[model samples]
Target chain A: MERKVVFAKPEALTDAPTHYCPGCTHGVVHRLIAEVIDKLGIREITIGIAPVGCAVLAYNYFNLDVAEAAHGRAPAMATGLKRVQPDKVVFTYQGDGDLAAIGTAEIVHAASRGENITTIFINNAVYGMTGGQMAPTTLPGQVTTSTPFGRDVKIAGYPLRVAELIATTSGAAYVVRRMVTKPATIASAKKAIKLAFQAQRAELGFSLVEILSSCPTNWGLNPREALEWVEENMAAYYPLGDYKVIDEVKSLK
Target chain B: MAKILMKGNEAIAEAAIRAGCQAYFGYPITPQTELLEYMSRRMVELGRVFLQAESELSAINMVYGAACAGARVMTSTSSPGFSLMQEGISYIVCSEVPAVVINVMRGGPGLGNIQPAQGDYFQMTKGGGHGDYNVIVLAPTTLQEAIDLTILAFDLADKYRSLVTIIADGMIGQIMEPVELPEIEPPQRPEQPWALTGAKGREKNIITSLYLGGLPLEKVNLRLQETLEEIKGNEVRYAEYMLEGAEIVVVAYGTAGRIAQTAIKEAREEGIPAGLFRPITMFPFPYDRLDEVAKGVEHLLVFELNAGQMLEDVHLATRDRLPIHFYGKMGGVVPSPAEVLAEIEKIASPQRGER
Candidate 1:
């Protein structure tokens, strides 16, 4: 008797092992992006820009042309790549510290210019590659290496809402925030990622999807508890929803 | 094309356009502002990529991206703006992508005034950013030379997959001179197997400067040093005037070199036997030729707009074999030809102990 294969790896992923920690959700998001690339059949013509965070080595896992940008310059790099090759689909995968802190100016300006590119922002509330430091998106009372005494809102300021801030830019055609705590939320996050790429394919404008990811090692929790932490702690503060969807992007589906 | 009177900054812009620069990114800065302004209008008309980035940091990173796509790209800025671009420049060089940068330099240690100065000589020639790498730096003495070198810079950058900088001063940027523009000829680029232009029918290409391990990083550094060696051997350029029977040779570059020409001519009129040796490639330094010239001349006089920045290179070239004299003006004060001639006279006079 012959048996049918139930599931397999995405065709867009290379046959290389990832360097992510055991409970890190970075692997989950990477797999989601690879699946989206496979679903759209754009692996041959898609280019990825990796930022200077844990995902800096993302180029090794994605089976497509990739360029590694400096700490916070991925958005600017993506703009250059897209402008020079208008037919190709270009995207940047950046972490919280890379996209929200040092690269704030670059992201804001890229969105303002209405550059036709996609960005997948990973907001894990801490700088993972640098060994758990207080990021711009760190929770008010969160503790990390830099904020060892628990974050003081008066000293470090509030956590930034990147999706809402980017949605305010007229150039951004689609901006959404989603988390992957459960199977249903994971499916929704994939849908948002697909939509962001679809918007770029249609040449509508800038599009972004900020994913509230889990950093189990930094958060000091097991993989199961980390998912629960994102559901109970991150979702309430972030408010998962679509922050910006232009009429053109809304009609994409 | 016919000889057209153009400002130095605008000529650099027009020259880059004719060289088939597919993309240009830059910000507004003194002296070099005209280059970006001219590119804004012409690149749009020519249907090329032209973006006025938020800062030099963004501009250079944009250029890096275009270069990684195998597109001929360039950026222009002044001293302060160039400082902001150092990190991007280091990354571009290490990634081995072809890109051009034009620094129409102005005075600076801080927000120093916007007057022509060569204070960036050390920065331009000897790896300004944090790394063990070198950039090909071309210094032009006149507007015409600036235009010619601007075109050559793009070709050299493509040939070596390296960064090429055109170092001009504020005087060169602001001056207007009649120059014969070259014909529009796109550079014949070599096969860029490493470009990030989609991996269709090929293996994925990755352009990155990151090498995590010591051995891997050392291998990258060795390859970079090998390329620098080849450039040093093949691209050392200089100009000599009346070195045959000269007792003194004036060493200079860019605006200072041009000023030295007038001073040398005055010294020759006074039977001082002074000639000029001007370097065209600042990084290559013309050490061999300068040393050969030192063998025959009695004195080597280094003239510059900064506080003897190139004097260090002169020292290394002659290695204390010949007496080296330096004359410099700081903080944007350009010395007149007469002033330089007086220094030449002092060296020539019979006050043997005055040295």
Candidate 2:
């Protein structure tokens, strides 16, 4: 049998030029969503909710039907659209500040309610669109525009562990954290996205894939150094692993 | 169609279901909580989506999401919750997505009393959310009109690709009255050949509100203004009662209109030529008709549950044209017909006596 080309375009994203800064991992993540949609053969029935922030214009970049949601409300919006049109594959693409901050309640309850939608959470540990302010996921001792004196754990409290906290929610059918900095990690990230879309298609409950990405422009580092910085500083706070899988728990129960 | 006695809140919920609204997202707020409770129990049985969101903000956004996918979706809340939802509401308006929001008016600058108050008149009729956008607002006085207008709200929303609001007070939401239930019909949604569900056999569709530059964004705003102007021209609705040969016309809406009706009856009995003008559409406010009535009427009394919100509109509609009298009760206090008649008597008395 002839080997087919696996690294082809996914129909989920449009072929238009992306507006992300050079070396930003957002472009890679976009490609991963497209690849997953193409692989699952559900690109035709997928509705993506774009969040306010850096990805506000994602509708133009994504070749699929994409709707822009208010800052931090992508998950809630996706929940509404998915429930109304159950047959449609709905997902929300959100950033750290939008998701872990303003949208905290929406994210928690959508997961708690077991909304049958997918969430692609891009955790860059800083507010990229707002000019690199410290984020909920910002690591201790890491300096950001708001935390110029370094993030004091005592003053700011410990960084939020969103994936770990959400894993404890029984409504979440699947929860995982993956990095997109390296080739192998990229493959795993792609696989995770595929699983999320598949779970949505199977009528499974809520699924969240937290992607560890780099905002080199905001991190005060060169493109190469930012990738390395994420691996060294961010990885410790946002650990990479499958925090929970509902099917496994269901079988045990 | 059969008429049955139902509470206003329950009537709105039943009307939503009958309008083929397949999803409802809401958080509990007094006066409007019954609407959510009714949907929670009925939606599942009807195979619709019902979710009690963690907050009003999320609930409205959930409605936004469902609407973007071409689903008829809605949420209900009182004043305070509606405040939290302003950001999301702005997004819905800017994005041109269709959804319905029910505001059961309550007194407030903060979490004021939960009793009926029409304090949200300015917020609902004027631009509540940030941006140059207007939502089609419908105010229903009776339970039957509540159900009928709720259905009409969805139709207007879909037809204009805009958000629609059914603005009523706590009194309307809590009161019981006879309502004729209409058959639920699915809205004629334009084939969003552009919605992103997946790429199967169709080209990818992108729905967004982002305009990168000034020129493109201005064009979007211009289009929105055009649509609003068209709506203003065609959708203004009101009811005129005994205004043809009346001297004083009482202007009101929702439950206040009901009280005004009673006040009109008493005023007529007392040999005063008083009538009522109840506005059903508060946004495309029955300004033209009110202006027409203002030409012949000597005094226009605006009765409201708020301190004096709707009075502003009444003043605008009749300013320079006639004299407009304002009477209101705040902090969830509902004015009695006697109280309103008293104000009318003061305004109509030949010799203006000292206060």
Candidate 3:
């Protein structure tokens, strides 16, 4: 039997080595986005805005024209870029800390305005870039740098459900929450990514797909356990399902 | 084109259109709300990009996005609102994106007042945001000057690839005057190899101000400093009135400068030799021209709406050789032309008035 190459690097992804920690899912998330852009034939005309957190170096990975936005301002930047060059496809890759906490105002307003853009929100539940600090998505009773005593719900508010909140906004044409830690969920995450891009291409308004990723180093667990943690804890709070989808997007093949 | 009587804010809006501005992002603040309102419609009708951002922070970042996309962009705001834009402005400065920001100044320190004030003189001329970067600031006294400078701002922005600010006061923003709009010649843009306009058939472009490691960041900083020095050497602008032979000079700009002109005429007719020095570009503060104006003058009276901010620059320019005085009215109070003359008369009095 002859073994041919079953896997190859996506041409849309740059050759630059990612600086993510061992077993971190940021690499997988990046690859999925690049794959979606390539499959849609938009890699030549796509512009991406990288957030200020761990994925701040996302520009180095994507071969498309990319710019780094301020900590939580990627959505606002995307609004401007998309509106200016309506013919080009624009998107932003933001992390939990960048999108939910510091940039809530930007994301809410951009979606409310029905901006023609796409956003990839990574919800790992902790601030991975800053050594595992408490994030808006931090689960109840989860310990972090700022919450050494196992996150007190009274002192620190409950975790924010970004997908649910944005789904309520009239402008969000497609909103979904998915996990990429398991092989089965990873396939669904890729499909969600594809559908989100399809929504943007159809000019159905704002679209977003929140992916629950693993940060083994920050979680103090091995790579395998980290995936299980996302599967058990994170998926429970942020359930995997479609939160919002417009009629036209739902009718897509 | 035809000379049209219009409000100062409206003229600035029309002028930006004539200058081939492709995008406008702004949040509504007093004094500049008209500018935003005008753009909200005109930009759409002209098939351009317009967005009323959620806040000043979003508005300025939007400008950053458009500039990164290689489009002519601008934003306008008032005092308190302008403060919120400092973070984004600092990023633009560090990234060296060419943009125009119009500051229709109002009272300061807090919500302040909506009335006309020059409290932002230092903020506009100096580096208001973090880092060692300066914005090219132009103070326009009249509606026509606002129209002219608004167009010039785009050229100077593209030429230097830096942020250029047109600093007007609430009066200039609200006042009505006849202005001849600059002819609409598609704006001149310089070569931008750093713009993030998709790869298409070219190499990928990244627009970021981040430079990790010491030596690399230092190299970028040193290059930016060199550009600033070049700007200082070439772009110094000012105007003089009755400086041929004078014993007293009133240094002012924007609305204060226009007020000083009246005071200079009255002082001259009252047998006191008085002249005016109006700085068109406040960053490169026209110090050399101020030295020339200070040659025969015994007193330099710097009048403003704030507390003696520009006087510091006057002292530096005159090298403290001549006696420099300051007369300011804070809290949104504009000094009358008579009040400026009275200060000048006090200088000319026998007692030299309380020094």
Best by lDDT: 1
Pairs in steric clash, model 3: none
Q: Residue-wise lDDT of candidate 1 within B300-334, one digit each (tens)?
A: 88999999989999999999898999999887888
**All-Cα superposition RMSD per candidate:** 1.4, 2.5, 1.6
Give the DockQ (C-alpha) for candidate 3: 0.83
Local accuracy of candidate 3 as per-residue lDDT tens digits, B1-355: 7888999888999999899999999999998899999999999999998889999999999999998887899999999988889889888888888899999999776998988898888887888988778888988988999998999999988888889999898999999998887677676578888888789899898888788799988987898888888888988888889986788889999999999999999999988988998999998788888987787889999999998888889988989998898899888898789999999989889476555
Q: How much is A171 displaced in model 2, in angstroms?
A: 1.2
Question: lDDT per residue, candidate 1, A1-253, as tens digits?
Answer: 9999889899789999999999898888999999999999999999999999999999999999999999999999998888899999999999999999999999999999999999999999999999999999999899999999988999999999999999999999999999987889999999999999999999999999999999999999999999898988888899999999999889987
Q: Each candidate: how many clashes?
A: 0, 20, 0
The residue-by-residue lDDT of candidate 2 on B219-336, one tens digit each, is 9999999999999999999998877678999999999999999988998888889999999999889877888888988999888898788787777777757777788888899979
Per-residue lDDT of A162-236 in model 3, one digit per residue for the tens? 999999999999999998887788889999999998998899999999999998988899999999999999999
Q: Each candidate's lDDT (Cα)?
A: 0.93, 0.86, 0.90
User: Runs in model 1 with CA error above 4 Å?
Assistant: A1-3, B350-355
Between the candidate structures 2 and 3, which one is better when assessed by DockQ?
3
| Per-candidate TM-score against the hidden true structure | 0.98, 0.95, 0.98
Candidate ranking (DockQ, best to worst)? 1, 3, 2
Instruction: Tell me the lDDT of model 2 at B98.
Output: 84
Shift of residue A42 alpha carbon in model 1, Å: 1.0
